[model samples]
Target: MLQRAFNKYIDNFRGFSREIWILTLITFINRAGTMVLPFLSKYLREDLDFSYNQVKWILISFGLGSIVGSWLGGKLSDKIGFYKIMIFSLMTSGIAFFGLQFVTSFEGLLVAMFFIMVVADMFRPAMFVSLGAYAKPENRTRALTLVRLAINLGFAAGPALGGLLIMTVGYKGLFWVDGATCILAILIFWIKVKEKKKSKYTDKEHPGEILTNSVFKDRPFWIFLGATLITGILFFQLFTTIPLYHKEQFNLSELQTGLLLTLNGVLIFFLEMPIVSYIERHKINKLKVITLGCLAMAISMYLLLVNQWAGILIIMMLFMTFGEMFVFPFSNSFAISRAPKGHEGRYMAIFTMSYSTAHILSAEAGMDMIRLFSYQNNWFFMGTLGIIGVLLFIWTMKLVKYEPPRNI
Candidate 1:
C-alpha cells in the first residue's frame, strides 16, 4: 500500500514537458539560494538594532521596488521576450545581493533593499510568461503546482540552512549564498532552455474569450485583483509579523522559528500537487477554490489568538500552508488564462503587482497594529481582512463567467 501510494504521488508529476522540469529546477535553485527574505525582518530588528518603525519603512521600500519591478518585467517581457528579461533580472539581482551586506545604516539599508527587490522581483512575471510558452494549456494548472512544489521544497531547505548560517557565520553569509544561487540558477536556465519564438493568439486558440476587453476595463478581473491583494497581505504576514511574534510571544530562537517555517514548506511540498490534481480532476471552479483558501487563512490568523500554547503555532502553520496550496496555483492558472494572446506579460504583471502592493501594506499595517494595539488585536484585524477578501472573491464570482478547463 505504501509503495502504491508513492507511485500515485509520482504519477501526479507526469505529462509535463522537459522545459517545465527545467523551469522548476531553476526556481528551486533560486528560491533556495535567496533565503535572506525570510530572515530580513529578524536581521534588521535584532542584528542591526533597527527600531520597529525603521524596519517597517525598509520593508515598504522593498515592496515599492517590487511593484516597479513587476511592471517593468511584464512590459519588457512583452517587448523583448521573457528569455532576456529573466537572464538580466537574475544576473543583476544576484550581483546586488553580494553588495547588500555592507549597507547597515537605516537610510542606506532602505535604499539598498528597495533597489535589490526591484531587480529580484522582475524575475516573477518573466517566469510566469515563460510558462505560457513552455507548458500545454491543458496541463497548465498542474505545471504551476509543480513549480510551486519546487519553491516550497526550496523554502523547506532554505530556512533551516539559513538558521545554521546565521549561527555560524552571521547574516553576511546569507548574502553571498543568495547572490551565488541567483547567478547559478539563471546560468543553468540559459544553457538548457532554448528560447521559443512567440506564438500569436487566434479565435480557435482561445474560443469564447472573456479577456477580449482592455485589461484596465475588465471589471471582474479588477475585483479579483482586489481580493488577491487582500489575501496576499494576509499570506505575507507569515514572513513579516508572524516571525517577530514567534520570538516575542513564545521566546522561540531563530532556529525554532525557522523550523516552524520549514514545516509550512514541507507540508506544501508533499501535499500540494495531489491537492491541485484532485481539484483539477473534479473540474472545480477556481474562484470557489480561492474563496475556500481565503477562509482557511482567516482561521489560521484567528488560531493565533490561542497564545497560551506553542503547539498552536504548528496548527496555525498547517492552516496557512493548506490555504497557500489551494490559492496560489489556481490563482496563477486563472490569471494566465485571462490574458489576451499577445499581452500575457501585461496580465501576469498586473496580477503579480497585487502581491507586491500587498507586501508594502502587510508589513506597514502589521507593524502599526502591533505598536498601537496588542498582538491579539492584530490577529483579529488580519482575520477580519481575510473575511473581507473572501466576500470580495464571492462578489467577483458573480461578476465573471467561469470557463471549465478545455481538453485541447
Candidate 2:
C-alpha cells in the first residue's frame, strides 16, 4: 500500500512537480538526520545532566534564532533568489548540527540549538517561497499537501532510524548524519534546481521596495495572520507539553513517547492528500477545515484531561492528529492566497514566524503552569487554548475572504 502511494505521488506530477520533489527530498534527508531531536531532552537530562529549566532555555534559544532566521531568509530570498538562499541555509544549518558534536556545556548546546533552528527555519522560507512561485491557486493545497507528506515520510523514518543510530553511533552521531544530509541536499539543489527570471510577483516592484505598507495593508493578510498566530500557539502541545506530560504523569518510557510522536506523522502521511482532495472537491472553504482542526484538537485534548487511562490517551492522540490534518495544510494554502505582489517569501515567512513565536509562548505559559500545578492541569489548559483557537478560527473565517479565486 505504501509503495503504491509512493509511486502515485511520484507519478502525480501535476499536484507535485519536479521542484517539489527535490525540495521535499532535501527536506526529508535533513529531517531524517534530526529524528533524534525527540530524544534530545533525554540526552540532555540523562547524559549531559541538565535541568528542566536549562532544557527550557534550549527550546527558547532555538525559538529566538528561528525568528531571526525566518525574517532574514525571507528577506534574502526576496533580495537574491530561492536557489542561493536555500543552498546557504542548508549548509549553515548543517554546520550548526556538526557543531553540536563538540558541545560539552549547556551554553554551547544552547548556541548550537539556536543556530540549528535559525538555518532550518531559514531553508523553509526559501523552499516554500519557491513552491509558492511554482504553484497556482487551484492545485496549491494539494501541492503543499504533497510536500507535507514527504516531510512526514522523512519524520517517520527519522526517529526510528535515529534510535538505531543512537545504539551504534551515540548522540553525536545524529548530528553528523544531519550535517552530511545538509551537504548532500545542497549539492542536489545546486545541480537540479534552476532559478528562473523573477516571477510576476517578484518583479512587480523594484528591489529594496519591501517595506511599502500597501502590501501589509491587506485586511485579509492581517486576518489570516491572527488565525495562524492562534493556530501556532495551539499546535505547541505536540512538542513542548506532550513529552513532559508523558513522563511526569503517564510515566511512559521514552521509546513509547517517541513512537507516539511518530504515529502523529503517520497519521499525516496517510490522510493529508485524501483530506485535501476531498475538501477541494466539496469546494469547502479552507477556513472550515482549519476550524475543524482546532475543534479536533480541543476535543482530543479535553479528553486527555478527562481520562486517566493510558490507552485512552493514545486514542485521544487521533483527535489532535485529525485536527492537525485539517488545520495545518489548509491554513497554509489559505495564507498563500493572501500574499500581495512580489512578497510571497515575506508573507510565508511571516506565517512561519507565527509558529516560532507560538512555541516560545506555549513553552513560557505551559512550563510555568507545570511548575506550579500538574501535567493534567496543563492538558486542561491546552484544551482550553484549543477551544479558544477554534473560536479564533471561526472568527477568521468570518473576516478573511476565502471566497475569491486566487490571482492567476
Candidate 3:
C-alpha cells in the first residue's frame, strides 16, 4: 500500500511539458533566493531600529510598488509579450536588491523598497500568462500546482538558510545572495526557454471559443476578487505580524521562527500537489474548495489564540498551510479560465493586484491593531476576516451558477 501510494504521488507530477518543468525550475530558483521578505519586518524593527509605525509605512510602500508592478507587467505582457517582461523584471529587480542594503534611513528604505518591489512583482502576472501559452487546458491547473510546489520548496529552504545567514554573515549577506539568484534564475530561463508568440498557440485547444466579456462586467469575478482579497489579507500575516508575535510571545530565535515557517513550506510542498490533483480529478467546484480554505485559515488564526503552548504554533502553521494549498492553485486556474483568449494578462494582473492590496492592508492594519489593542485582538480580527471571506465565496458560487454562459 505504501508503494502504491508513492506511485500515485509520482503519477500526479507527470504529463507536464518540458517548458513547464523549466518554468517551475526558474520559479524555484527565484523564490529560494527571496530570503529578504520573511525577515524584512524583523530587520526593520530590530536591526534598523525603526518604530512600528515606520515599519508599517515601509511595508505599505512595498505593497504599493507590487500593485503598480502587477498592473504594468500584465499590460506590457499583453503588448510586447510575457517573455520580455519576465526577463526585464527579474534582471532589474535583482540589481535593485543589491542596493537595498545600503538604504538604512526610513525614507530611503521606503522609496527603495517600493522601487524594488515594482520591478520584482512584475514577474507574477507575466509568468501566469506564460503558463496559458505553454500548458494544455486540461493540464493548466496541475501546471499551476507544480509551480506552486516549486515556490513552497523554495520557501522551505529560504528561511532555514536565511536564519543561518543572519547569524553568521548578518542580513547584508541575504541581499547579496538574493540579488545573485535573481540574475542566475533569469539567465537560465533566457538560455533555455525560447520566446513563443501568443498568437500561434493561444486558445488553439478550443478553436473559435474566446471569453470576450469585459472582466469589469463579470459580477461573479468581482465577488470572487473580494473573497480573494480577504484571504490574501489573512494569509499575508504569516510574513508581517506573525513573526513579531513569535519573538514577543514565544521568545523564539530567528532560526526557530524560520523552522516554524519551514514547516508550513514543507507541508505545502508534499501535500499540495496531491490535494490539487484529487480536486481536479474529482471535478470539484473550485469556489467550494476556496471556501473550505478560508475556513481553515480562520481556524488557524483562532488556534493562535491558544498562546499557552509553543506547540500551538505548529498546529497553527499546519492549518494555515492547508488553507494556502486549497485556495491559491484553484484561484489561479479560475482567474486564468475567466480571461478572454488575449486578455489573460489583464485578468491575472487584477488577480495578483488583490494580493498586493491585501499585503498593504494586512501589514498596516495588523500592526495598528497590535499597537492599540493586543496581538490577541489582531488574531481575532483576522479570524473574523477569514469567516467573512468564506461567506463571500459562497455568494460567488450562487452568482456563478445563475450567470449566463459567455460567448465562446
Candidate 4:
C-alpha cells in the first residue's frame, strides 16, 4: 500500500510539472554562459587589440542588434508560431556562441556580438510569450519565479566557474564551454518539449499590427512607458558604474566584487517567493509596492557611492533586495494583466526593451560621471532619476483609467 501510494504521488507530480522544467533547464544553460560577460570589456581592450572607441562601437552594435531582434522575434512569433521560432533561434544562438572561438579583431568581434545578441534576445522574447501562454494566470508569478530560480542557479555557478576556467584552461576554453552548453540546451529541448498552439484568440491579433500598430496611440501605454523609462534608468546603473565604485572607492578585490553581485542574485532567488507572499499580505497598494522596490534599489546603489566597508554594502544590498523582490515580479504580473488580451508578446517586448536601451546609454554617462566628478555622482544621478520614477508611478495611478492592479 505504501509503494502504491508513492507511485500515485509521483504521477500527480508529473501531471503538475508541465514543460516549465524543460524551459528552465534551457534558460539555465543560456544564462550560465553569462559568467564570461563581466570580464568581456577587459578582454575586448586587452586581448583583442581594439581601441577604446572600437570597443564602444562593438557594444553599441550588440545593443542595436538586440533591439532589432526583439522587434523581429515578436513579429515572427505572432506570424509563424512561438515554438518553431524558439527552436530555430536557440540553435542559431548555439552557433553564435561557437563563433566566439574565431573572432580576433574589432570587426570580427562586432559581427560576432551582433549575431550572438540578436539570437539570444530572440529567445528571451519568445520565452516571455511561452510563459504567458502556458501558465494559468493565477500560477503565472510562481511559474515565472521558477524560471528565474533556475536561471539564477545557473548564473550563480557561472561566474565562479568561469573564473576558474579562465585561469586554468584560458579564456578560449571558457568560450568553448559557452558554445557547448547552448548546443546542449537545444538538444535537450528539441527532444522533450511540447507546445500548445494558440487558438482563434491569436488569429484576431495577427496581422496583429493593425491593432498593435495603433496601440501606441493609446495614452496609457505611453504613461507606463514613461514610468518604465525612469525605472530602467535607476535599476540599470548597477551594471555600469557599481563595479567601478567597488574598486575605486571601496578597494574591494575582484572576487569580492563578483561575490557581491552573486549575493544579490542569490537573495533574489531564495527570498522571492516569501517576499512575494509578504508583499501580497501587506495592506499597501500595488503602486506603493512597486515604488518601494524602486526606492530600495535606488537607495542601495546610492549607498555604494558612500565610503563604506564590504559589510556595510552587503547589508544595504540586503535591504534593497527586500524591495526588489516585491517590485519586479509583481510589477511584471500587473503589467501583463493590464495588457489587451492576446497582445502579451508586444507588451512584454516594449517593456524588455526599456532595460536594453538603459544599459547602452548609461554606460557612457556612468563612466563620464566617474571621470568628471566621481563614481559617487553616478549613483547620485541615477537616484534622482529613481525619485522621479516614483512620482511618475504615483501620477500614473491618478491618470490612467484602467482597473486597479489586482495584486501587490
Which one wins on lDDT? 3
Over 4 Å off, model 1: 42-53, 102-107, 167-170, 202-212, 247-256, 309-311, 402-408
Q: What TM-score fits each model?
A: 0.90, 0.88, 0.90, 0.87
Between prediction 2 and prediction 4, the one with superior lDDT is 2
Worst 10 residues of 3 by lDDT: 204-213
- Give the runs in model 4 whose Cα sits over 4 Å from its true position: 1-16, 203-210, 278-285, 308-311, 400-408
RMSD values for the candidates in order, in angstroms, are 3.4, 3.1, 3.5, 4.6
lDDT per residue for candidate 4 within 1-408, as digits (tens), equals 999956753432232255777888888987787655766776788777688899889889888878767767766766666687788887887777667868887787888888788777877667877877777665566566667777778878887788898889877777778877877887887789787686456547354554455357645556666767666665556567766677877788878877877788888866776555444445446667777877776677667665766677787667566656756676666555555555666666666676677777678777888789876677788777777777777776665536455431
At residue 345, give the lDDT of candidate 4.
63
Q: What is the C-alpha lDDT of each candidate?
A: 0.87, 0.76, 0.89, 0.70
lDDT of 2 by residue, 1-408 (tens): 999987764544455568777877777777776654777877888878999889878878978989988887887787777778888888877777787877869888788888778877888777877877666667777778887887788777787888888899788788788788888878887799787556665544454455355346666566667766766766777777777778877899978987887788887776678777777868887777888888888888778775467887678778878988988888777666666555666777887888888878887777777879977787788788777777777776675555465532
Candidate 1 contains a number of clashing pairs equal to: 0
User: How many residue pairs clash in each candidate at the backbone level?
Assistant: 0, 1, 0, 1
**Model 2 segments more than 4 A misplaced:** 1-15, 201-211, 402-408
Q: Which ten residues in a row have the lowest lDDT in candidate 4?
A: 8-17
Error at 294, model 1, angstroms: 0.8
Per-residue lDDT tens digits of candidate 3, residues 262-326? 78877877788899888888888888998899999999999999988999999999899899999
**lDDT score for residue 345 of model 1:** 85
Question: What shift in Å separates residue 298 of candidate 4 from its native position after superposition?
Answer: 2.5
lDDT of 2: 0.76
